[model samples]
Target chain A: MNPFAQKKIFLEALQALRLKKKPKETATKTDASVCPSCKESFSKNALEKSLFVCPDCGHHFSISAQTRLDMLLDAKSVRFLNRRLQGGNPLNFPSYEAKLAALRSETGIYEAVVTAVGKIGGVKVVVCVLDSRFLMGSMGTAVGEKITRAVEYATHARLPIIIFSASGGARMQEGILSLFQMAKTAAALERHADAGLLYISFLTHPTTGGVTASFASLGDVILAEPRALIGFAGPRVIEQTIRQTLPDGFQRSEYLLEHGFVDAIIPRGEMREAISRLLALHGRTTA
Target chain B: MTTPKPRTAADRVALARNPLRPSVTDYIDHLFTGFFELCGDRRQAEDASILGGLAFYKGTPVTVIGHRKGKTLEENLRMNFGMSSPEGYRKAQRLMRQAEKFKRPIITFIDTPGAYPGIEAEARGQGEAIASCLALMSRLTVPTIAVVTGEGGSGGALALGVADRIFMLENAVFSVLSPEGFATILWKDASRSQEAAEIMRLTAQDLLTLGVIDGIIHEPPNGAHEEPASVYLALDAVLTRELSVLCAQSGDALRKSRYKKLRAIGNRKEAL
Candidate 1:
């Protein structure tokens, strides 16, 4: 079976485990998520305490952008930027707008990325975090513009920037115009780099394609979450192109770090601390 | 000439990929003089897929780089059928730096399906190389122009195409991915590419309308392959006029205007 197909079964099994672990008192369906790795079930409150990392097996369950913001920034210090920006159906692809609307109401997010600026270890930084549940965190026009604007905000603000990327790639519904977003975001980053500002890219599970080939790779320091799949092409695409089943653990974060593409593989529990420590070292640039 | 009728997106796709279509090698002898070929990324082996060198266009020195897709099967394998690898982009980056250092205008011809998707490419940082090229191309101080001669597939094409002025031939197509890939990914049906192509808005005219390109260079009826001379003449005139106009601007002005062009794409509404 394909790795992803196997993952589907594990996901179903994990859901069943979540139900079983729910306590009789105040045990709601939304109150627990089971780890697919260790098959260990934990209450949502417990998972929040662990920063969504499974304490038993150390598997990182992907977190939402809101959770990420709260984890990275100080409580009540989070100030969102460009939350009103959304994408129209430029290509007029059938049902794309309707799909976006459905995802919006379901996810309670305006777009795939949440651009914000807040204190991390008491030092302000701009961030654009992608949540995969919403359209697999694709880089559509809105996502690109938000990231570009955030980077631009950082350049002028002289603040550090961080992006937690977990995208499937560029959105297909927007067609060719979706591709231009790559160029747009990268240009903003180029200008930011020209200004000698610090930009950190944190790659999460299954970041690939346009996202991988653009800003995610342009970071001055590129970091990935443990076991995250990071590459330009998806593993299935690679296997189909080469007509071979990939070796175990191919395209994982360990493979990338070993190849020198990633600076380090950071686990979820330590991500905020790691980012803040790096920020402390770089400091704020005067120029 | 027959009355020009609109071509279907799939028709343009086939026409752009027509093996008989004129490649970069066909245009060089017709457009430039004293072409001296440069090689290597300086960090690794030289990439044949990306052909970069110094040349004199209309007696003015300039840097010329292109994704060289070979015509024949054996030649295609030799050039990886214009599917550039990490080294190919690095090679382009080196050439771009050289062009900036010497104050020469940078012109690139894009005609790649996309970056080479293979295990080795993944191991060597294909994403990093393509990203580096995109970032560097955006900031180059010299006047930079890119023309899509054929397939401008995804980041591989965009890596070479971030320029002050971008254009495409009448029949060329540029997109986020091939329609086949799109269909397969979206609908799990590769055979529906013709349907996918219809909505992709990848044709040159579509790109021009969307403001993804500055303009479209007209090709001869029945495609540029049938009669190459007219296409060359038209492209030559466009380049000569654009190169002269861009070259006259100061470095700061060129950089500012180019940055504006990059920022302006997909910004037609506040919604995006």
Candidate 2:
């Protein structure tokens, strides 16, 4: 077995040992959660307190955009931007409209990205966070427009910008129009940079594809959640293309930091504090 | 003298993918002198799909980059059938940055089906790599030109195509995605790709009319493959002329104009 696969088995066994003592930690407690990576179980409330990071193995679970906003921003602090912007089926892709409708109701997300003006550690900032639950947070025209507008908003306000990227890539259903967002968002960010404003990119679990290609990698300071997978392409494709087995822990945040792709691997628990410290250092303060 | 038979969008696609067509190497050999290839992205293994190098165009030193499509099956496999990986775009970015630093005029040839669509490519951040290239190319201070020599398919083509001036060969096709993909998605019939090709506004003439491309280079009676030497000569003259005109401008001017050009793409005013 692959080294990573073997490690996963060992972790499962260890977790089984812990579970043996607790007869109540059964499937009936489905509302509670288990870390797929470390196989450690926790009550949903406990996991929320931990910010969804697995305490034992440091695995970062995919958090919804709403949850992320709640964790990162102050109480009742968010003023959403471009909430009404949505993508039309430009290519008239069959079933795309229906799929969008289904996804909208299912995810409670209008689009893949949520752009908002919010307070983080009492510092005002514009944020565009990607919700992976919404079609894997694919970058469509609407998502791109939202990000660009948010960056523009930050530039105009002279406030800092923070973006949390979690995407599979350009929306396949949107066709080339979707791919073009990479350029659109990047161009907007370039103008934002011209204003000499600060932009922070927070990479969560599975930040890949066009999102990683553009604004995510263009941050003044880039940070990744602990053990988050951050890369342009996944390991399986790489392995298949090159016809070779990949090294253990490939494309993980720790591996990326070692390779100088990211500034640091920040655990979820310390993320708020870290952002606060960064904003303070940048001399950006709330009114 | 018979006029060149009118070609459909699907026919043009076939022409673009024709095995006998002149590849990037042919263009380099016929256009530039003292060509020296620079490989590896430095972050990962070298990607063979994108061929980037330094060469002297006419009497001036320049940087040349283009997709490398192979005519033979073995060579095509080696070059991933001209489909680039994340490392491929990164390698292009590395060279482009170098070009910007040295003030060398950058010329790129666009001819790819798209970036490789595979699990590993996505894992590696293929979209990010391509997006960075678009962002980087847009802001590069040096003069930049891109030629759509064949199939300018999706983000893969756009990666090298965010230039100050974009020109397409008479038979080349540039679209957001492959017609087959477009057809499959829109019509639920992949065989209706020909219909998608027509509706996509992807042919050189359509793109030029739409102002998506700056200009189009006229090919021979059949296509570029029918007369490679003449096609290369025509491209050479146009490149030299454009390079000289662009090179006369300040780097800041080039950067500003490039940014404006990219921003105006989907804008109502420009699209109108």
Candidate 3:
């Protein structure tokens, strides 16, 4: 740290993440974490025991892609896919390369989304889990290519696929090419769907922008975690355009269920059971 | 392909957003015949922003759809200045399916700021609507073409842009979002739009090289708005040539080719 690295500047850096929820003031000295939705704090071990779900208010804290993989996949049944495909300074956007590199070492992942083939409930499936830690899980060229290749693989392998999306939208640093990723991913999913393969789109917190408007919304059965912000555009953009404060719980998973956009709101604990059950049912023949 | 007079990104952006520029309504009048405008998603409401229906393109039955731009404030309000709601996209999807069922060619003229970002739009499932359109268009067996007549904005424009062939007019601009929005979202300064526009590489020439678009249709020296008839003629020539080739393919062949073309966007040979 610089000799003059003050508390204020450190705090500002934490808040500058552009995340839907700011980190809960990381200056704490205790071995406890606070829930952003509810004002309750608990020991880190307690939070992990509940899978980071707030025991009091039931708020689902975001989890890392690795944490999610460990929770969903069976023991030693995971093989990563498309790790060679990662982001570049495609448009030469200033500081983009530096930011991506910083994120790489910080998150220990090559890109925002991690694609792999793994077993869920002992049933093999191709899975994609978008970690918002890197660029808010934005879909740029590499993220798009990885997903397209994932869907293509599932189509070829006759495997059901599930994608847990946690994104802000298109990666603006990559410019128009980021927006085109929407079409690219959807086009690949079209081939997958045509083969009569099952696709379950699992939207996590803060899935908006290009991601929501693409493959996330195209899933035959779309599922979301409780209270995840899933929509085409962000709430701030919508509020600014509408000139009105959104009603309570607007654009939330519950709201989407009320509006029929999502099939169900499955909690983090139930996700594995729900997804694996769907995959099993989909594989069944007429009886 | 570079021409003698290269337009700065800013210049192309300005020309594309010019109010006097030709709109989808004008193009339909000039090129299509026996036009019958379709309305309503048959779900709840009719979105005035996107207008689509049956038409004859040079005596060939086709389904035409596009974002509607208006000349007056009231008209623009009626059309929501071409920013679609979920219903607009649903209407487009309905039309695309109709075209596919009947085996008629589909042509879409894209020009919009984007899907309307408002409370009502979200309430109606805007993302699902656009995603459904892309899914349906990607697999459509009929010949399809999408032209960026003016502004091709984000998912709203892309909802209709998953085509077998996509072209952009010389002055038209297509990007993830408006330069102003980009600057605002990234830097919290909308005035940096010109700088953002430059980096966006949204012009037809840039997109062609990037393989984001298939071709470009040249406009007159003054601009397409100044010489609407010439713009129409040029587009007519391009569409006629392209459609003849696309129409020759079998349904299975067309489906495969469209899938391959769209899948190639981020799969650039210089992939990371």
Candidate 4:
């Protein structure tokens, strides 16, 4: 067997051995937990088929970047732009390099994002998917560079651009350099806009901090995934500083839509169709 | 006349002796004659932060684009604290293009803290939005004038600030980054914002001397926020005078002048 396959088999056998040793502990009675919004009990197989959404309640849980890419684009259609781009330990922050290595292994993706230039329902687009599993998809140099290059490609090709954002905020490890990415990305987007190309933004779960204040909010049509937390600062920090209770659904996608921050709120299942329709409406199609 | 006391907590307490500033609506009503507010970018939903429309300044037709910060909580939320998203800049670009096509002079009132910072904003290409505005303004044929009415922060301010004549209110400040942000980045403590502010050279007078601004439109003795009507009248006079000079130039001349004006900023001659 190949090394990867050998490793996988070894891991599976080790897990089986552990399970055998802890059979009594693993066989403990399970407590039923249902999604409060959807009133659907969690099932591993059902959730897998349903994109981790509650089948009964339709509550969309956070999804990984790869899963999102697979769900949005045509089967095997994604052509990622810069797969080789990687982050370095710029600040030499203790354990930062090791953390990145760990994240890379866990997520099976380089950097915080993977940008693809591909067709979604025959419409040409530059799509960037932020992997929340990797340091919460922070905007580091690699992430920012990938985004800038994607915009440049879209602008040059006169194709519409769409980016799915799911980030905790700017990477704290890179510090001021990470903050500079905001201006850099903004400058690039400005060039795309001048080219008269359409750019759409899809904000996903738990988007906050510096990312919220810069390029993420600059879409021609700003759409938020259902229940995504979109804001400059998290509610906990804001409340702690303000010394007051926040309103219900503060920074939630629905609240933002009502408050005019988001152009639309789209469910996970319908997002691809919605984006395709928008692309068609804008005449941004290759086929 | 003796200069007003330096802005401080004590000064602010003393200034409380005066009344609060006039609302943006009130200022516009008093200054703009035959004003008509335009809505939407015609491609997307209307952005409340960027207020664009046609207005008459002393009987001369001019297009007005202003960053508006509302007063109450509802209004503030609506205006997004005068921080525009991509659509806001797009709306301004639309208006500016229309103004150029119609041969009308363009006047912009800048007060935004910065462009809106959010994931949706980035995903939508906020950087492209601001850059597009800058590129469009750079090559615009019509006479363009920008007045810094309040806080002019970062690329948001620059999006509407590429003009033949850029004016600043006495109390207004313009900088590449906010003082608090610079302080936090440079000193690792946001509380040193006052020191950062002084070092940033962002005051209207400082910018005027640096040639980043064309002229300083004197605000009320207290500030524009205190007596907006007086500030607006002063702005009206300066804009009228600047517009006449800008209107006389041809398209090529306008583009060249603007290019020169921008290129001149931050250029220092070496001493041999």
TM-score of each: 0.93, 0.78, 0.93, 0.53
Cα displacement (Å) at residue B113, model 1: 0.9
TM-score of 2: 0.78
Error of 1 at A206 (Å): 1.5
What is candidate 4's lDDT per residue for A1-287, written digit by digit as tens?
24344333323333443354321122122444467686767644345445556767777777777667766776556788988777565444458789888988887888888999777887778899888888888886778778878988999999899988889776766543454455456656766887888999899987766566556877899998888888765565456545777777767888778767789998765677789889888983568
lDDT of each candidate versus the true structure: 0.87, 0.80, 0.87, 0.71
Candidate 4 per-residue lDDT, tens place, B1-272, comes to: 78765775223222321224443465568777888888887766789999999988778788989888887789889998788887898899899999988989898888776777664554454655775676677678888888876677766777788788888777777765566665665568888767666665567766766556788878666766766767777877887677788888898799767766654443322100
User: What tens-digit string does per-residue lDDT give for candidate 1 at A128-181?
Assistant: 999998899999888998999999999999888999999999888888878989
Q: Please give the lDDT score for candidate 3.
A: 0.87
Residue B5, candidate 4: how far off, in angstroms?
A: 32
Q: After superposition, how far is residue B21 of candidate 2 from its true place, in Å?
A: 1.3
Q: Is the docking of candidate 3 incorrect, acceptable, medium or high quality?
A: medium
Ranking the candidates on DockQ from highest down gives: 1, 3, 2, 4
Cα deviation in Å at residue B86, candidate 4? 12
**For candidate 3, the TM-score of chain A alone relative to the native chain A:** 0.88
Report how closely model 4 matches the true complex, as a DockQ value. 0.09
DockQ of all candidate complexes = 0.72, 0.30, 0.67, 0.09
Residue B2 of model 1, lDDT score: 72
Taking chain B only, the TM-score of every model is 0.97, 0.96, 0.96, 0.90
Q: How far is B52's C-alpha from truth in model 4 (Å)?
A: 17
Per-residue lDDT over A104-183 for candidate 3, one digit per residue giving the tens place of the 0 to 100 score: 99988999999999997688999999999998999999999899999999999999989999999898988778888898
